[model samples]
Structure formats: structure tokens, C-alpha cells
Target: MASTSVSKKRKREAGDDAKASFVLSTQPKSQLGPVLANFPSVKPSKSTTFSCYQTGGNAKALGDADDAEFAELPTLIAGETDSVDFHSANQPTGCRYLVGVHDKKTGITTIRPAPVHTLARDVKALKSLEPIAVSVLQRLEARAALGETFGTKKAKLAIKAQERNKVDVSAMETVVDHLQESIQKSTQALPSKEEAQATADSTRLVPPYNAEATVPSEVYPLHNIIPEAEWRTLAATPFLVVGQMQRTPLLPFQRSQWINQHLHSICESSSPSKTNIKILLYISYMMFFRKFAIQSNLGKVVLEEKLASMSPVVADGLLSRFTESARSSSKPQFTSQKETLLLTHMFALCLRVDDYATDTELIARDLSQSTQSINTLFKSMGCQITKLTLTDLKRLGLPDGAAGTKRALLKVPLEFPKPRGKRRRK
Candidate 1:
């Protein structure tokens, strides 16, 4: 019985060893790769696009009553600067411009861009007409001077042309008077009559005006956005930007927004709406004499935001540009590189916008190379050097209310204190 049991155990052991050997021989070789089954290759459909929260989240107001697509983008959140995407190197420590949206709650002033469509005044269309209006004014003034020496016939013809183009003599006179005063102060020779004649293009259309006060629609127009009293005050004097100054007379970002809103109106309207042309000539004039600072960090931010939002192509182009540099390549997207790029681009664009500046590329090159300071750049462009007046600061988006008013007031001390020697420590 013992001998039979031993033989059975031996047979069992032999069978188990044989099975192990067979499994070892059947195993895949090192080069045979992974043994797990491969998933079927997923062929992405051409029409499909990937959407994420931060990317394609904003779709036009979702139709359903229950569907609440957030209407407002949250303002810069607390500790947003700590995000992995934020690169602080070259992030400017201070901004040149004083204009900012002051939050009364925390007393924090942020670069909170105001909607350009507000103020119900068509500053954009007006802005476009300002130069032509100026030209008509120049021709009128020239003819008027010549009419004094020559005859009223020439001046009459010029006035007729002004009337024909729909240019307002009142507004034109205000601007011209300011300009002449500026030229006189600078002691610069006034533009020659022949030069004015050479530059004049009578064919240009003068921007139209709104004679009728608009009734309140679903949206507020000029009526509510600007109080009648406030409008009257501003329109009364209309402190015109007559010449270039080292300081920016008008904010480029604001003007850009206005321009965009105006262009959009032109595209959307079957015809140019009165809304499009209402505040026309004034904006043109302000922009005409406003300084464009190449070295301004604020301008940098504006330019960057503009490029980023314009289209993916522009953003991609910017990325491609800075990515070449090792320093820029490693830094996060929201970095100084963008600021630098934007600042440089703004400077270039400003130079390009000046019809007077023939060598715009050279000027842009010098600025991009850091050979010119922002102050110097604008000064070279013949901008008048002036700080934001109390009126302008108040006109900009500051906090409201009597207490809010004084606290938010951006008044610089009217008088300077006499310099004193340093205090001697006891």
C-alpha cells in the first residue's frame, strides 16, 4: 500500500512540472512588447472640438430660462497672482496712468476696463471726423486770412465747403483756438497756408451730429449714462487736446474700445445708426493730440490684452515670437514677455497712426530698441507734457458719493513744498 501511494505522488509531481515548462516556453519574448490587448484606435471626427471650462465656456446667452450661463466674468480673484500660470518677472511694480476702477469696498484700484459702449455719446465717429473738420477749419481760416488780404469770395467758398461737408464751425473754432494757443506757447511757427492747402482734402465727409434728444429705450443712451448737467459742463468748454504732450491726453485703451464699438455698430446696422455718429468729432480730436507712450507699462498691458483678445492667430503669433528666447520660453503665459510685446506693438502702432510721422518704422525701431524713453518718445511726437487734470481724473471712472468723492479724488497738491535739509538723528 505504501509503494502504490509513493508512485501516485511521483506521477502528480511529474504532471505539475510538465505544465510549468509548457507555460514558460509559450511566454512572449522581450521584443514582443506588452501582453495586454490594445484598445481600438479612436479616429477623431473632423467636426468635433474639445471644450473646457476656461476655454469655450462663454456661449451666447443659453436660451433656456433655467440655463444660467454666468453673465459676468469674475474680477481678478484674490491670490490669482499665485496661479501656476502667472509669471511675475518683469511684471511692472507701478503703472504710469492714474486711471483705474477704484473699488470703494476695499479701496483697491484695479485695471477694470469700462464698457466703451456706455456714455451714449458717439465719440468714435466724432473722432474720425475731427481731422477733416480741422482741415476744413484750416482752409476756412487760411481763406479767411487770405480773404482779409485777398477777398471774402475765397473765404466764402471755404465756408460753403465747410457747410457742405457738415462740419460745425463752433466745434472747429474751439479746436483751432486751442491749437493756435498751443503753437503760440511753444513759439513754433504756425503751419504755412500752402502746407495747409497741400494737406487739405475737401472730399472727406464731416461726421454728422444728433440734433434730437433720444427717448429712453430698453437700453440707456446719453440720457442716463451721463447726467444732463454733467454733459452740459463737459460740452460747454470741451477742453480740447490741441497738441502732443509727453503725457497721454486720452487713454488708448478707452479709445480702442470706442473704436471697436463704433466699427461693430457700422457692421451690425443696416445703415450707420445715429448711435454710431452721435459723439463723433470730439473723440477724434482727443485721439489726435493724445500722447502715445512707447515706454508706458500701462500701454503694455492694454496692447497685450488687445492682442490676446483680437484672435487666436494674433495670440499664436505673439507666442511664437517670444518662445524663441530661452527666458521667455520657460516663463508662464501671463508674464512680462506679453507686456513687453504689447508695449512695443502699441508704440509701433502709435507711430503708424501719425500721418505726420513719415519714418514710422524708424521711430518704432528706436523705441523697440529702448533707445528712447516714453517721455522722450511722445515729446518727439510734439505731444504736450501734462498730467491728468482734476477734471480728467474725475471724468475717468473713479468712485462716487461725497465721502467716496473726496477719498477717491486724484488731485495733486497745487503748490510744491520748499526743499529742506535731511533731519539729523539725535
Candidate 2:
């Protein structure tokens, strides 16, 4: 009976050893390799009843082992337990673990191991690897949390910004239109007759006899000079031409004469002895021209014409005279043909629209009064005026009939006078 019992015990012991050995060897290489490498010297403790072992400050136990070789068994079991813990700990939580069976005949090696929270803690303690592990986990979590990719978020933001820009552009256009209308109403109320008579009297006191006194004695046909039928077309919205027409007399020629007279008077009165006269003249010219251009029908009509009609030669000559006057007046030199052209063009365009001349008589009257104000301002600055050429007039886009007449009067063939012989030494 004693021999049979010992035989039974040995058989059972062999079976358990076989099971543990098979588990350590037959498991997948990915699972077993790291486990064995990290805990190669694990050992079982003497006080433990089961196959208990310590590895990396962690302990694990298998089945009880009575009368076993504790001294050698501790080391063997420790090594085995560490191997199992390492391999099992690395497996995903959902993966099945093979903890029991030994042979292929049984085909039942798969067994679930108990939760190994301690091994997980040990893995976390590896600071060097923690970042990589955390990064992988975070990526997985993020993928699960956010269904959309980074590109989608960027596109959404870009679309929102574009929508905002469109709103701002529309608001700006509305504001511009409102300001333009207000200017028109204010310009209609200016005093017309008083301003025109004042301008005429001032001109009589200056050189280049006033056109009213010098023109052909035969009443220049004033009939179609400004067609009555064209009055509606010629008149602009009140404030639109205030700066260009200066004041309207319902006649384009009359407006032109008024501007010319005012400018001439300003120039004749300025003395050559004044210091910085050039600077004053330039400022005065700009202020007057800008004001008149803004109010004049001629100023408006000329601007509406195409660029081809603005004779460059005439424009150049007029600019040269403007510059010369500034220099002669002893003022700061004001040069730049481009700036002059741009200002002239803007003035012309402003007057061409009907909005600036809706009430012709009213606008003309306002311009006349404003001209006096403008002249007073210029006189205060001590500026002398210079005559602008027909080319300059053409740049303003005056009517073809007016432009042609002026061109005919101003045009002259270019010629060079013969050079005299050099003087002989005395």
C-alpha cells in the first residue's frame, strides 16, 4: 500500500512539472522570450507552500507543493513564475492565456490566468518606456474619441474666416454712398450772384483784361454755346460738383471765365519781392484749381473724355508753367506730373456725374461764393498764380469744341533760332 501511494504521488508530481515546463517552452515566442530574459534568476521562497517566486520585487505563486525540493524548487519556480508573469502581463487584457495543460494529446493548454495588477505596476515603473507606452495609448484613445481628422478642422476654420471678410466689404460700400449724398445737399445752398460779381470785379483789377471786356465786340453767339435743351444733362446733383464747378451760372463758358479771372487776380496781386512766394503760389494754385475743378462744368466735361484726348504735349507745357510759377514765387518746389494728373482726373470725374449738378444755378451760385473764400485763403498765403496751357485744359477733358478752339490758338510749329558766331577775344 505504501509503495502504491508513493507511486501515485510521483506521477502527480511529474504531471505538474510537465505542465509548468510545457507552459514555459511551448508558448508563443513573443510571449515567452521577454519573460525569460527579464527574470532568468527568479527563486521561490522557503516559507511558501505553493510554487512561489520573486522577480523584480514582485511575487507569484502556483499550486501547493508538499515534500518538494524547496531549495532547488524555489529557484526553478521563481524563474518559471517570472516568465509567466512577464509574458502574461504583455498580452492584451482580452487575449486568452494558456496556463494549464502539458501535452498535445490533451489539446487543452489554454487557461485564463488571474489578474496580474502587480506586473502592470512594474511595467509602468519603467520611466524610459513610459512615454512610448503612453503615446500609443493616447493615440488609440484619441482615435476613438474624435471621428474627424485634422484636415477637416482646418477647412472649417478657413471657411469661417472668409465669411467674415465678405460682411466687412459690404458695410464699407454703404457708408461711402451715404457720405456722398450729404455733401450734395450742403453745396446747393451757396451764394451764386454775389460770388460771381465779386470774382468779376477782382479780375478787372488784374492783367490780361477780363474776357467780358476783351472778347469780340460782335455778341459772340451765345445761342447754342450752351444749348438750352442740354441744361438738364449739364446740371449735376448739388454737392457732387461743388468742389469742381465752384459755382454755376448755368453756362460752362461762364464758369470757366470765373475760374480764370479768379486765378489771374491772385497771381497779379502777389509781389516778386515776397520770400517763399513759390511755395505760397503752389499751395494757392492747388487750392484754387482743386476747388474750381471740383465745381466747373468744363472741369467735369474734360475728365469724362478718354485719356487719348488729353494731349500730352499740352499737359506737359501747362505743368511746366505751374512748376515755373512755384519756383519764381520763391516757394518750396512742388513737382510731380503724375500727382497733378491724378488730382485733375479725380476732379473731372467728380464733376461729370449728374449728382454734382442736379440744380445748375444753385451749384453755380455756391461755387461763386466758394471761389471768393478760396481766393481769400490763397491771398493769405502770399502765392502767385501761373497760367495753365491748353494742353492742361485738355487734360481736364473740356468739351471738344472748347478744346479745339484753345488748341488752335495755342498750337505753333517747333523751330530753333540760328546760333550766333562766338565772340573773338579783345
Candidate 3:
């Protein structure tokens, strides 16, 4: 009966997708209609009923539902964010839309869409109903709550695939167009067949053109050029061209891989002063020598060579100093046992005690000094050791001097030790 009534109505007004009485209009200031004012505080339900619908990406007012008038609404590309599904019997016949809210803390997405018309009419309090708004503010708020993935549809996958396909096809088409253009240009540039044959025939070695007057002598530079013939025949040259650039020796210090990177650039940029380069080379050599001089393995010959590299005068002076002082003598030291004991005592006494008269008889006791040589011992004593000792002072005697405290210093000896032969300076 209902189908017959709808058929009669449609025929009366020229059949339309929706009959006039049932035609939905969202032309008011808000697509949500009077629902906003009616339900100022429409709390969402535990079972989410809304989802966001992305209309053709432009900022078109959804109130212009006429644009999609013939098509069904909410062409849901990807939705299923939750497990709850509505029964088929409860689904709406007209266009449907989505509304959603997001909960950021829980990462939950909730959406509600246009409810069944039967449900809308059955409910007394409209506060239970939530109408879908054209403004995206509701969708934005929902996203903030649930995050984008929880309740949102992935409708963009199909759209992205389409865009990718379009790009590929456009690129292929452009390549084909360019190839066609090049092919056409080449074809137009080609000479006609009759002219091509005549030109080829003219280049051939026929009579009156070369030796048979066929090939022209003037066409080749090698045949008649005197300068080229002279150059080919000449064996010895009189003049020479020398390059102005003289290579600067890159010193070993600057040969490090790290330094090489910048060394050439720095050298090229430097002012043309050979003196400065020489000075820098000498300085690096000296620095290297100074660092290596104390090494035990260094030989005198090598040292001399290094010193001579700097200057002959420097080498001479260095050798003189080496032989006189720094050089170690190979002669074995011969010290009598008593001489050794006496020298040891002298070293210790000098460290702990200050001034005292040198005793010649005591020093000459059993060592090889035919006569007392107290002066030699005194001369070898060096500076008095500043390190003070109680026994040393008592033995030498005194807060006043060592004249009366002999028993106080039995541990220390009074006699000065004999010194060995002096190392004479050259």
C-alpha cells in the first residue's frame, strides 16, 4: 500500500529520487536546524553513534546538501573504530551524517550521527538527541578527546591512490608528448631524398675533384700548411718556455692527512716570500730537534747531522758542549772502599749540617790522597743542603753551634769525606 501511495505521489509531480513531502532541506542558518537550541547540553551516550564525514575537502557549507542530492550521504570510506554495530532495521532511509568527539587521555573516539527519524519522533525530551552540525568545530573537539585514529574514518586511502595514479599517468603523457615533438622536429629537419643523393655524389672522389681531381687539397690543413710541415720536420728547438711556478717543498710536519686538507690552500694564499717559507721550515726543524734531544737512543752522529742541518756554527758549539758536559765518559770509576764510605758520609753530612771547618787529616785517612786534600772536599760540598736534622745539628753542635755537643751526635761523623778527581771543563 505504501509503495502504491509513493508511486501515485511521484507520478503527480514527475518522479524524483525523493517525494516532495519527504524531501529533506538543510537550508537554514545552521545545518543542525532547531536541534541546537533545543538540546543545549546533549550528553553523549556510552555507545557512540557519531562519526565525522569529510565532505569534498573545500569549505563548502553542508547546508548545500543539494550538491549531493542524488547520492547517498556518509559514503563511509573507513569507519569501524568500535565494535558496536546498529541493526539493519534501525538504519535511516534518507541521507546520513557523522558527529564525533575525542578523549585524549583514554585515546577513545566517540561519534554520533543523524538518528533514525522514528527515534527522533518517539523521544519526548530532545536533549537526548544530538544533531549533526555543518561546522567542523564538533569534529575538531572530538579529535582532541580521542586522538585522530580512534574514532576517525580513513577515507583518504582511496583518494591518495587515485592521486598517485593520476600523477603517474600525467608523467607518462608528458613524456610521450615530448617524444612526439622531437620525432616531428627531426622528420622536418631531414633533407629531401633527391637533394641527399646529389650531395653524397658531390663528396665522392670522382674525376676533377681529387688526385684524379677528386678530393680537394685546400680542404685539408696538413697538405699545404708550411708551419705544420716545419714543426713536423724540426728536430732541435732554439727557444724554450719555462713555467713561472716553482714548487715549494711541503715539510714533513705539514704532511699529516688532517693538515693536508688545508695546507695546500693556505700555501697558495700566502704572500710570495721565500724567506718566510724558509724561516717556517727552520722553526719546525728546531722544534722537532728540541723535543727529541733527550731521547736515550739518539746517536751523536744523528745529533750532529740534525745540528748541521740548522747551521755549522750551531753544530760546532753543540758538539763542544756535548764533549765537555752532557756526554757520558766510558772510563770505569775506581774508588777505594774507604774512599766510597767517606764520600757517602760527606754527602749526608752536607745535607743535614751547615758550615764547619773542613778537616784534611780526617778526609785523607785511608783514601789515595798522599797528602790531606780538605780543599777538594770543601769545593765538592756544593751549597749547604737546607734540609735540617736534629742529629746533624747536635753533632755539629748547637742552638749556638756544634762546639760542645759531641755526645748528642754519636750517630753522625765529624770527618769530611775526600772528593774524587774533579771533572775539568774544556
**What TM-score goes with each of the models?**
0.16, 0.18, 0.16
Per-residue CA lDDT of model 3 for 123-206, tens digit only, reads 235446898666675664454445434533554454444446554555587589789999999999788977875575454321
Q: Score each candidate by Cα lDDT.
A: 0.32, 0.33, 0.35
Q: Residue-wise lDDT of candidate 2 within 1-426, one digit each (tens)?
A: 465533434345444544333333433332221112122343334342323353344454433333342221222222223322232233223433333434566544443232221122133245356344568747744754453454377665664565465455566886887888888888888759868656654432111212232322111122112223322222223313244334333222343442333333333443421212222222223344335344542222343342222234323332343333343564323344433442332222222221111112233343454434333322222212233356645564454554322111111121112226799999
Model 2: CA > 4 A from native: 1-91, 101-110, 113-334, 337-350, 353-426
Task: Say which prediction, candidate 1 or candidate 3, comes out ahead on lDDT.
Answer: 3
| TM-score result, candidate 3 | 0.16
Q: Count of backbone clashes for each model?
A: 10, 37, 22
Which residue pairs of candidate 1 clash? 122-279, 125-280, 126-280, 126-281, 127-280, 127-284, 244-383, 244-384, 245-383, 245-384
RMSD of 1: 44.5
Score residue 101 of candidate 1 by CA lDDT. Answer: 48
Q: How many backbone clashes can be found in candidate 2?
A: 37
Query: What does the lDDT come to for candidate 1?
Result: 0.32
Candidate no. 1 TM-score: 0.16
